[model samples]
Target: MRDFLPADKARRERVLAVIRERYRAHGFDEIETPVMEEYSRLHAGLGGDNEKLSFSILKRGMNAEAIRAAADDPAALTDLGLRYDLTVPLARFYATNRAQLPTVFRAIQMAPVWRAERPQKGRYRQFMQCDIDIIGDASARAEAELMTASLDVLDALGLEGGSIRVNDRRVLDAMLDVFGFVVEERPGVLITIDKLDKIGPSGVVAELRDRGATTGAVDALAAYLDRPSSAPSFDEAGIRAALPTGIPDEVIAHLVALGETVAAARGADAPLVFDPFLVRGMGYYTGTIFELAHPSVDYSLGGGGRYDGMIGRFLGQDVPAVGFSIGFERIVDLLQDAADTGERSVVLVHDRDVPLSTLLALKTALIAQGVRVRVEQRAKNMKALLERSAADGYASFASVGVDTTAESLELRPLN
Candidate 1:
């Protein structure tokens, strides 16, 4: 949906390099999948709202007969859809190649995904997702490592003073149940709650009421949201005390362990926080969910969580997996606005009679020596040419007349 010019593209690549280096340092190996995948896989009820906005590809050639036969159902006419995220495709990839992969796989994926949603300021219909996932390891350590790696990437990018709001799906479910929400309404309720940052408490209450929630339920939910904490901390005991029904001890312990590990590793100034109301929209997230927030930015950098059940759709058995995705597009956008590219180049001005091959050889040699070079015929006014070159990020100029050999070219700095 966007075309990146040289400077913009360079900034994006710089951010990607930082991400790739950080992920590799954390022992994640990269993998790639096709942009399009089976429509059934994309619509597998795991991606939450993303599934609804997926762009499907219609059946073609011989498959067109099926479309004609099943005209009543749009899905029958569509065989594939562009992948909305990397997680689902990774599930399929692992399921297909599980035998070749290690028992515990730490994988990194960087790829563009498509969605058909209406674009907003930072949200795009097509954007890149940079994901690091740990599969086959169900321990709390996996979640901690993922969270730590994500924070480390942000730190590498100089994005400080940001906080990661952590929560557990089980705790959210239990709390919703206590608030008189039924099983069927939990997803809708959680999805709306996920918009708390954008819509605020009053908007949420109105939306809940419009969605058929009772007056008492709405008021109780609002009152609970008012439970004050000076700072975000995982206070399972306080939460359990406030609600009569307690959350599972295992869930509490896992969360506590993750928080402690991250804090100790990151020292006293660690940015991890516990916000009970942080309900990420992905429905497949079975355990922990988190969102990253920064004071300098209005939107989240990125988020992800434990989708222990997603791979089951492919492998027929649950393969515990947890992942975090950095909003690559958004990160690049921020970096581009603030990037100071220390790039310099030399413009090669050659006589009209200079052989094209000779000029090409000079260009290649300069490129090999780590110099950015551009070649053009000699301009009439040398001062004007040098001025133009300097304005366009070139720091120097080189002359290659008909008598000048590739080995005897003279270079002069503009400034």
Candidate 2:
């Protein structure tokens, strides 16, 4: 969907390398899945709105009459669709490869997913997703490890002022139930609450009422929303203080334990926040959910959560899973440009009169000595040529005469 120039590609690869290294260090093995999957699977209800945005691949060998016959159901004409996100593919992958994988698998998937999104700042039709997932473990440890490794990525990128906002879908369910909302209204209520950041508390309440939600439930939630957001802390007290009483003890305890586990690794210094209204958009998230936040951005850098039921849909058996994905496009820009890489690479500026054999020999000799060598015929404007080389990340350049040996070349560092 886009073209990355040499310099752009280099920077991207450098950043990806750092992410892969950190994930691998945490014992997650990288995995790859195809860019396209069966159309029916992509349309499964798990993807939320992303399903509608998927790019479908029409079935081959369909005659004109066949295409027309299926016009009423355009989707029937398609056999596959480009993946809208990595999680779905990861689910299918585990389902098919479970026997070859460990009982508890930590997998890394760094790849591009396609969508038909109206491209915007930080949003693209095609972009890289850096995900680390743990499947087959349903405990808080799975969520904590995800949070820990995600935070570690931000730290490695030299990104500061980052924090993780935590919440549980069960907590929302408890809130709705406590407020007297019926099960049928849960999804409608969540869609409104998820807009709290955009519409604010009063707006969310007003919108719910406009949508003809139950009056008593709306009032109850309004009162709770009006309460002071000043939390006690990120511990059990904090979790309870943020939510009303009657929340299942296990939900509260699990969230508290997750915070404690991550804190133990990152210390109390860990930047974790408890946001009761945090609703990740994916319909498949069955339990704990969270997003990566930085002070500098209004949107989450990335987010993930527990989808303990998703793998079951694929494998026909329950496999607990949790994952975190870094917003590669968003965070890549946030990171300072990579440090200059000129030292290890060199440009050989040669006269046009130099023999091709001489140029190849010189290039080979420098490459053997662990340098990236590029032979360029000297342009009329030597300064322009040197500047171009520097822009390409060459650290220095040396002029190569026909008679000059690799050792005799004098290297001059580029400006």
Candidate 3:
């Protein structure tokens, strides 16, 4: 088990509380799911490239023996894996429980997800994901609300200065089609182009070339993706002026309107940027994609996209959905750096005059008063008790010995 010292636990809980309060204020209902889930539901196309990182389970009876035998073979059982992301499970949940739920469901979930990746500074084999998603809405207003809520949550968490970058998949798809790339190969192409930030323009070109994209298509894509965010603004007029050789004017108008709506939502305090190259990695995302990043962090703190078709795979009917997830562990690490170090006082008690029940009652009362309390166990004398409390980071102590009265207890502060 991972050991979380008292100080660390306190800090984590503080951050979590802020997140919960902000999400709750926005009308999102909290929901939870089991840590373990059947493998096939999680391993389907839902998880994207991270699907291989899932941790699977074993069953009992003949099935258990079969799983054990398959474990020996190494390649026999791949269906029973742990949930890789919360959105897929939420999609499954809505499909199964839709009849009992409202036409529009807004929910928040905070839980630990297991990933078998090599651990690093901020990356762990196990971590928590705090997510919010809205289902059954096709309007861009739902997308706008999600983005606003995400920014509010981060701001409430004390990330005073940051950016929530936004982009639409349709815009990028139009750009690709303009450059003569076939629609069937666009997903793979977008995946490679999304790596442009990690690998430079030349690297992206090389990858696209390796994937059988024509030189002309690769060159145009590289130029478009590499353009600076401030290269030029495209209003309706500018969009019409730059229309590709054979594309329809109506398509350009729709793309232009989408951009206008996103731009109008920006405020003076929190600015949104549009990057044509921002392609979220999830294969199921059919519309807009977004990511949150801070100037101090080297990677995205969190991200998500619109996956309107995901539910159709399970429910046999279309349910438009959009979601965003915060990397809970990463946020915790960031908040730890920003947290203030204040004195924490825990009252440690010992003695027989105060029966065990009375001591516990006192502890509970102190807790109700918002005071931290820790009853030291195994200390025989005041000196030992004080020393142990000091070592354990407690600043105060209360003792009830055999000679003490129930109404009058001894209290002391340890230096």
Candidate 4:
């Protein structure tokens, strides 16, 4: 089994507590789905490279010969696979159980998703995704709410000044059309330009040229995408002046509306910055897209966007949806680097003097009273126990001896 020592468990619990509190305060009901699901249902909404990563399974009861035969023929494989993300399964869940839920459904799910990816320092094959989504409305209000709630979650986790970069897909599409690029080539152009922050302008131009875009087109795209953060904000006349050639004024008006909505929703605490270059990696995003990044971190901590058509593939009907997922593992890694000293403590009772039942009861009571307690497993003297607790970074410890009373247990504050 993977090891989760006392300190690690404590830190994870603290982060989860903050996440749950912030989501619930915004009226999101907590729901959970099974980790494994039928492969068809899991893959129905996901497209492109996402389908290849699904971990499919076969029934265990099948005979060896039959299993071998099925394995040889891809069509004979069964339907089960591990869920890659929470939103797709949740969409299926809502469609199947719509009658039971309210017209407008808001849910917050915290669960692990499996991926067949190479493990690195902060990347894991199995990691938790903290997701929140709103369904049944196509209003900008839903988008604003999701963004506001996301800001609250990150702020509650101590990332107060982080930036939430946002951009509209319509704006990007209009720009591509104005630059004489076909609609079919938009994805390639977007994916390449999305990496501009990681790879510089020269690299993006090289990638565009390699993707069959002409040299002139590549130069224009590079200059457009390379607009620095210091570029001046557009006033009414300036916005009209910056409109792409041949695009309708109505489309530009819609883009202006989206920008105004986002700016108005942003509070004084966490300012929302308009990022024309922000395009999420997912192929399903059909509308406003966003990514959250810390000032000091090079990679995005989390991101999500509107995918109104993704769920329609399964239900065979349109459903309006928008979601944001927090990268819990990445956040944990960043927190490890920036973690300040915490004040919580756990007391370990000697197994010999304190029976397991009594120790559990004490723990439950203390927990109810807002005290964090951990029962000691290793056999050691009081001095060793105290030293171990201190080394684990605890601020205090409780000592339960044979002669200790319920009302007057010894409490030791660590140095």
Candidate with best lDDT: 2
Global local distance difference test of model 4: 0.73
Q: Determine the backbone clash count of candidate 2.
A: 1
Clashing pairs in 2: 342-395
Task: After superposing candidate 4 on the true structure, give the runs of residues whose Cα lies further than 4 Å from its correct spot.
Answer: 68-75, 223-243, 246-265, 268-270, 337-384, 390-395, 398-403, 406-408
Better of 1 and 2 by TM-score: 2
Instruction: Work out candidate 3's RMSD over C-alphas.
Output: 4.4
- Candidate lDDT values, in order: 0.83, 0.90, 0.73, 0.73
In candidate 2, stretches whose alpha carbon ends up further than 4 angstroms from where it belongs are: 341-343
> TM-scores across all candidates?
0.88, 0.97, 0.81, 0.85
> Judged by TM-score, which candidate is best?
2
lDDT of 4 by residue, 41-82 (tens): 766646556667777787657798888888875436766888
For candidate 4, the 10 contiguous residues with the lowest summed lDDT are: 229-238
- Model 1: per-residue Cα lDDT at residue 8: 65
Off by over 4 Å in 3: 63-79, 225-266, 338-345, 349-365, 377-415
lDDT of 3 at 358: 68
lDDT tens string, model 1, 341-384?
Answer: 56657899988999888888889888988889988788789788
TM-score of structure candidate 3? 0.81
Ten residues in a row with the worst lDDT in model 3?
Answer: 229-238
Q: Tens digit of lDDT per residue, candidate 3, span 368-397?
A: 867778876545566776776665557777
All predictions: root-mean-square deviation over Cα? 3.1, 1.4, 4.4, 3.7
Candidate 2: tens digits of C-alpha lDDT, residues 1-415: 7898777777788789889999898889999999999998999898999999999998999999999999889577999999999999999999999999998999999999999999887779999999999999989999989888888888887786789999999999999999999989889899999999999999999999999899999999999988877955888887888899889999999998898899999988778899989998899998999999999878889999999999999999899999999999888787647666434888999887899999999888889989998888888989898888887778888998889887798998987
Model 1 steric clash pairs: none
